[model samples]
Target: MPRTVSELMTPHPTVVEVTDTLHAVAQTMATQDVGSLVVAEGGAVVGIVTDRDLVVRGLAEGIGLDAPVGQLASEELVTVGPDDDLAEVVRLMREKAVRRVPVVEGDQAVGILSLGDLAQALDPDSALADISAAAPDE
Candidate 1:
């Protein structure tokens, strides 16, 4: 059976506004136990902010916690469709060097598919799972 991105995606991912402070975004991530947040504006996704983005783009650049996430978020989003083939989406992820891609229906973000999701779906015991789940500096 051909699987789909929706089948493996984490639905209704935690979200925050583009104007949200980094502190608030971090709090949401920690509370949700998610590594990334869908950056939204007027209920429509505009970008994505990940923990790595916080470190590499926010802290490393000396951007204060009170600053708007829009400054550090990835404005050029690479997204996928819910019905997209899992294999094709995986290929896209590798080609684009993205760990996660939002699953969009029109302009709305309905879910997110991460490399970890693929690892678990394709091979639950694969080493990718360990690497994907590993905490930074581990």
Candidate 2:
């Protein structure tokens, strides 16, 4: 089993500027086939935006797509280092009630560790692992 986040995390995760519009964020997510994006400012990770944010906080709230993504981005972001222990990361995730955490190296986002990554790496036989491993439906 992978012992550290670096071993299981999805590296080179898609990133977007905080000033990017919701429409841009949505397009990036669609193009990248990712549910979450690391929001950066001046090359530093500042926040994270998820597909859920687009719907619940943007569309449902009647926020126009032209609005900046920072409006819906979770600014009080939680992060982890690539070398952090997987167990500790899992604990932090549960405590923070967050599903995804950006892995940073001196303010630069190197990767993203997600619940799906944990499930797939730590328990390959689990249902979540199976689902996470399955290809996305077109």
Candidate 3:
């Protein structure tokens, strides 16, 4: 039987408002030990931001940490539904060149699906899966 996104996704992903500061964004990622966050506006999903976005789009551009997180967030958000198939998730990740994708239910972010999540579910013996399954460093 094929797997569904909800089966492999990390539920209740951390979220940040679009108006949040980049500094706050970084702090949240660090404290939560997550690589990405779902960006929201008016209680609706608007975009997504990753640690790489903080470095490449914000820091590398000399953008101030106090700047709004939207400055660095990828507004061209790619998302999936919890009931969607893993194949579709993989396709979107490939075409969009995104490692993380928010899983939504009626415009509300319910979870996050990441490449690492897929690796763990689909190829548990792979290095990526091993690393994904390992506990985070203290």
Candidate 4:
């Protein structure tokens, strides 16, 4: 049987408020060792911010790190419910070209699922090896 998204999702993913500073968000991501954060307000997900977002949108735009995260985050939020099938989640991620997706329960965010997380859960060695091989050499 195929795994459900709930089975693969990282429960209780870290979140940040729209008012949070980009520097603070970066600190949170570093502390949590996560690449993305769900942007929430009043217990509802409004957007998402990733490390790439900081580099591509923030830095490229000359926005200071002290600027509000909401100023640079992608407002077109894409989300999935815990009960949603894994295939559906993958499809949405592919269509949106996003690596991370927030998992919602009603109006609140309950977890997150990333392409890496899903790939690892399904097949660790092969997935990791593939990623490693595709990564640019340092």
Work out the TM-score per prediction.
0.90, 0.98, 0.95, 0.86
Instruction: Give the runs in model 3 whose Cα sits over 4 Å from its true position.
Output: none
Error of 4 at 34 (Å): 1.3
User: Once model 4 is optimally superposed onto the true structure by TM-score, how far is the C-alpha of residue 30 displaced, in angstroms?
Assistant: 1.4
In candidate 2, which residue ranges exceed 4 Å CA deviation? none
Kindly list the per-residue Cα lDDT of model 3 for residues 12-100, writing each as its tens digit: 98889999999999999999988888999877898999899999989999999999997777868888999998897898799989888
Cα deviation at 116, candidate 4, in Å, is 0.8
Q: Report the C-alpha lDDT of model 2 over 1-138, residue by residue, as the tens digit.
A: 789999998999888998999999999999888899999998899999999999999999999999999899996799999999999999999999999999999999999999999998888999999999999979
Segments of candidate 4 deviating more than 4 angstroms: 129-138
Q: Pick the candidate with the highest TM-score.
A: 2
Better of 2 and 3 by lDDT: 2
Off by over 4 Å in 1: 130-138
**Backbone clash tally (model 1):** 0
Ranked by TM-score from best down, the candidates are 2, 3, 1, 4
CA lDDT of every candidate: 0.88, 0.94, 0.90, 0.84
Please state every model's RMSD to the true fold in angstroms: 2.7, 0.7, 1.2, 3.4
